[model samples]
Target chain A: MQLFRGLSGFSLTPTDAEGRVQADLLGRLLQRIQAAGVDSLGLLGSTGGYAYLALAERQRAVRAAVEAVGGQMPIIVGVGALRTDEALALARDARKAGADGLLLAPVSYTPLTQEEAFQHIAAVAEAGELPLCIYNNPGTTKFIFGEDLIARLALVPNIAAIKMPLPADGDFAGELARLRARTPDGFAIGYSGDWGAAEALLAGGDAWYSVVAGLLPVPALKLLRAAQAGDAAEVRRLDAAFQPLWHLFREFGSFRVMYVIAELLGLCQLEPPRPILPLAGEVRPRVEAALQGL
Target chain B: MQLFRGLSGFSLTPTDAEGRVQADLLGRLLQRIQAAGVDSLGLLGSTGGYAYLALAERQRAVRAAVEAVGGQMPIIVGVGALRTDEALALARDARKAGADGLLLAPVSYTPLTQEEAFQHIAAVAEAGELPLCIYNNPGTTKFIFGEDLIARLALVPNIAAIKMPLPADGDFAGELARLRARTPDGFAIGYSGDWGAAEALLAGGDAWYSVVAGLLPVPALKLLRAAQAGDAAEVRRLDAAFQPLWHLFREFGSFRVMYVIAELLGLCQLEPPRPILPLAGEVRPRVEAALQGL
Candidate 1:
């Protein structure tokens, strides 16, 4: 499937203070992403605060997303959990609720062995019965995917793609080539760090699984398209406009800065689930300024 | 309180394939720790797989533990959760279920800011009402408590102690001195790395929050007593006997090793909740060998 190969815009699942998914608000956010003509919509991902939501709430978010923009674009749902059974259950719920694809993160409370993570991902991929993306987010999940593990996973049935972190050494071309050589044909490889996305796409990476695009899709799309066209100059120009926002994402964490972005953009104002506090009032001015050009 | 300042044994929670707590088996494990006269019972700490259990299951676990050993020793229940409100609710649940104290790790998916962690711990302390120990486990939770943050938490009401990871520099005396200087008179500080427990205690740590003590309480208790009595030779001798087990713990995580230890001792054999698979079949012989002379 080509579901994981383009500008996949992530969207937040608005929830009340008690974490019940605010379906209408979530629908509206999805509608925005669909209207902007992004390639896919990622629901219940890190930006959606999936880890903070209970299974019932996550199912509710998926159902709301499907109802809002089910056919408008490919709806890729994040089905990651600390428990493998929980992830499988979520994957079943997502497919039943009408999601078109799945993204599984190796979420663990205990730092997992690579073999354990491999089995967990393989189990979910087999159980999902939907194309799955390996969410290689070592930053939040803390389980780094070794090259051998990724190669092995790429061969697993229903495992279709990967969403990589920005390479520590910034060698996107080198990493992409190595992965491509091992992975079977048409296995999509994507990148997620909003700041490094342009370079990833320009380096011939297949997708940009974006967080900023959750709120501001047009600018992110412009950069993605420029990279796709192999116009490095145009991509850099668009990326420069995003530098200020990217700095805020890095400084305050993209997850927190995102709430501020949604509020400033007049979409909806909701605090992230607690234990992750909202950005301070003082940081709002900085967020406001970061939104200048875009 | 005195609850935070002694050998606190953490036990494995024997759960079935569905993760339902086996009350009788759990009670059997608790009895062993209690019979050995561990100063306190740390129910549902990391070694207990508290992260994998649902709140209802954790409540069942707390009730079972209290029934087994409530009047015999202080029960410090782990109330760590990804969400702040959930942790507060768990704290309330443990207290109502007859817990004598609380242990909280800043469990997070979105690696928490120090300010966020501080407010979270403070909120739980206020809601918990029982004396709470800060579970500063950066390895498990990935939320490193800055010295400044730990010092700040020490000043909060009802916050009684801290359970620390071993220092990279192995400077327990320096770290303990710095923490004690900032904390109030009796703000207890303990260490959890079982391999380092003897040294931590020998260097004057207030408690050894232990995992091996969950199964082999007799030998673990002996080590703790030696450390407490300032018998360096005896402490070293006992610690030497535990070296093979400690080596296994370092090779495989202590959490995974505990399950094998349970089976070897004729306790109920249970796999850790998956996606944490049981140790390889070959590793069992090594576990058997590690159990010698203890």
Candidate 2:
């Protein structure tokens, strides 16, 4: 119940100088995250290293994260694909990799009906005994999940949480009212309100999927710890420093934004695979300036 | 070669009493389409059936169609999926199922760059020796085949045609011009321009997909044959009678409108599967009245 309760950094894809999955680098990254003392780690998520990797590559990423964390923290692995069978396969692999749970987003490419969406979640739930967290990133999938669908998914036994990409204007208040009313208090509700994390956390959310937590975990964790303690002053102060990084995610595309920020801060240096163009060259200077300014 | 010429009917999916794939009914539908003397048969496309059928169901639909036509006509199957490997697998299966050719839509779900789109087409083309027609239905897939992408696809070996869904506005005209400049004259270029079949045929397309042909093949083929003969008078007369069907397709939902017309005319009695809810019950009578009036 309420398994995740702090800033959960969606980890990046770890790569060596040769641009392959660098297990050592991943282990180091996990150690760094544990040092920052974030509540949890989100591996192979959209922000984490998932879509960019092949199934084997993704498996390595998940396995490395689990082994590196060594029970120091819980890890939520992203399970997304086009086929129900493939998504299910990934869920099983993640479970085998010792992930604490899965973050299941609807398969990409085909638009799913409410019934299909419900069936997809059920399939993933049955594939693994691990607790499942439904991911709602409509911007990437082009398929928005209605409240009715979410309510239906809440009934699936293994579904323990929902990590929703909050809409800009009505992120927390509207969804929180509906989800809190339908879902039991035991279920983790993560607000991927992205930039609006501090306000949303204050407004009430069990955890957050934070891009900032990947590089600046101490500040991100401090903000969440303060929010949990009802320290608005601390939350506000951290949010201001963190606001610039959030702004970068908004200005650039989603997949490559974090990697660019990572390269700038010397936290990690890895290029996204082809088909995902890098963040603009100009944005790099601004990211450096923002990190320094903070 | 010009595999599909003149008007082709995108056949409807047929389900049995228990609401499973009814091969017998599908066979009948294809037989009727062939007996009706339309130029080609489009099976397993968006209009042929729902978008999210399982791989087995898709293969069954294709087999049923091919068996029913029994080589009496050209059967073009649509093989579209999100994964490169899955789509290629479908292409190979379609070839074995004895389909005359393949019409591929870009993989659904993920946002694709132009290079990914080109690679998808090339991969499918390489999968089988059968002639391939790239289906451009941006309305459904949220992918627009830009001029450069189309030009690159034009050079893809075994890609024999383009099945473009023409927008209501003349937006496809520029792309058509660009394709015309890049492709040789004998290359087949068809339109899934349901409402504007006559106009598109007049505009130099080798063939067109027709939902209208399913219910009123006599009228649809009359219009096509007349247009082919340059008999403007006969073409206008048939178009006038058929204008009600075209207007219905344009004014309301085409899938529902066409299915209702098919049911009313006793072509395929089974209704669309769930989530693709039918036209309102009250609208059915009006559709009936319009069909009778036409």
Q: What is the C-alpha lDDT profile of model 2 across B1-294, one tens digit per residue? A: 236678877877776533358888889878888898888888877776535466788899888888889589888888886556667888999999999888888754436667778887888888967888888887667788886787778778898888877755765556566678988665677787566776677666778777767656777788888888988777777777766666777666576677788788777666555434466688888788778756
Tell me the tens digit of each residue's lDDT in model 1 across A45-85: 89989999999999999999999999889999999998888
Residue pairs in collision within model 1: none
RMSD (Å) of each candidate, 1 decimal: 0.9, 6.3
- Give candidate 2's error at residue A168 in angstroms: 5.1
lDDT minimum window of 10 residues, candidate 2 chain A? A271-280
Compared with the true structure, the alpha-carbon lDDT of candidate 2 equals 0.75
Compared with the true structure, all predictions reach lDDT values of 0.92, 0.75
- TM match of model 1 to true structure: 0.99
The DockQ assigned to candidate 1 is 0.85
- The candidate that achieves the highest DockQ relative to the unseen native structure: 1
Model 2 residue B261 distance off true place after TM-score fit, in angstroms:
4.6
